[model samples]
Target chain A: MNGVHDLGGMHGMGPIDPEANEPVFHNEWERRVFAVTIATFGGGNYHVDQFRHAIERMGAANYLSTSYYEHWLHMVETLMIETGAISRDELNAEQTKLAKEAS
Target chain B: MAVLTADMVAGLASTGASCRLDETVAPKFSVGDHVVVRNINPTGHTRLPRYVRGKRGIVDRDHGVFIFPDTNAHSEGEKPQHVYSVRFTPRELWGGDASERDSVYIDMWDDYIDPAS
Candidate 1:
């Protein structure tokens, strides 16, 4: 699929800048997202390619604005729902519960 | 269904999975053979980059048999085939303004390329 993730040779996006002393993950949520993605991946829900395609399927705006591990999170959620491991309602309910607890 | 246990996490994390196959497959193009990238725009998953599509290049090396991602992504099958590192001059890909001294090497599967006519 031709998506923004396939950015190659397109100009004006700005130079590639390396983050000084870049950490493996920038946030605690990112770390959790990574672990969950890897763990669910081990469940044989989808292969690497499918995992990548899920990320690529993200909306152009969302894909550009999100961080790397966020893309992983998106892939995990998308695949999990698609494979019937979880449903949209279940995920939404969990999110709502978490939000309520946090508040 | 296989469950990922606690003990398995360490081993699995350390040694990630590899798609390389042990199966012997005949290569379609040899080193130094000219080839052209296929202009395929499948709505499904594909490893072929947009920049290299329909571009001319030469097979630099054969990386051996591996699972083809295009099919593997969709649960179609693991169409194991030879993957080649094709070298394309910058000019060929990005036009004459690009430096002739630099070349781009892209790993291409058998389904992504064809013999240059």
Candidate 2:
């Protein structure tokens, strides 16, 4: 798939600036996302390539704006829903509940 | 579905899963062989990058048999085949203006390339 993720030769994206001692993850949610992705991957629900293709399927605009771990989260959510392991409604319900709890 | 327990986390994290297979698959091209990348644009998952399509390169090294991601991603099957480190000259990939001193070696599967005529 010719997706935005393949940014090898394209120009106009300014030179990358290396962060000074970048943290492994910027947020607590990122840590959980990584763990969940790994766990779900271990469960053998989908192949690693499938996970990658899911990320690629993200629209160009969304794919460019999101962070790396966010991409992983997207892949996890996409596959979980597509494989019937979880439904979009269940995910939405959980998100709504979490939002309420956070408030 | 297999549940991933806490005890398994450490090992799994340390030694990540590799797609490389233990099977002995014959390679289509050998080291120093000139080849051309197949101009394929599959809608499904493919490891072949867009830049390398239809480009000419030389086989640098044979990385042995590995699971083919193109089919594996679509529940098609592993379709294990030899993967090679193909050396593409900067000029060949990026045109004459590119530096001649540098080269890009990309891992290419047998299906992604064909013998150069």
Name the best candidate (by lDDT): 2
Best prediction by DockQ: 2
**True-vs-predicted CA distance for residue A20, candidate 2, Å:** 0.5
Local accuracy of candidate 1 as per-residue lDDT tens digits, A25-50: 88899999988988888867778999
The 10 consecutive residues of candidate 1 chain A with the worst lDDT sum are A38-47
lDDT, residue A7, model 1 = 89
Off by over 4 Å in 1: none
User: Which residue runs of candidate 2 sit more than 4 Å off their true CA positions?
Assistant: none
lDDT of 2 at B76: 90
Q: lDDT scores for all predictions?
A: 0.92, 0.93
Backbone clash pairs for candidate 2 read: none
What interface RMSD, in Å and to 1 decimal, does model 2 have? Answer: 0.9
**Chain A fold similarity by TM-score, each prediction:** 0.94, 0.95
Model 2, docking class: high
lDDT of 2 by residue, A5-83 (tens): 8887999988899999999988999999999998999878887899999999998999999999989999999999999
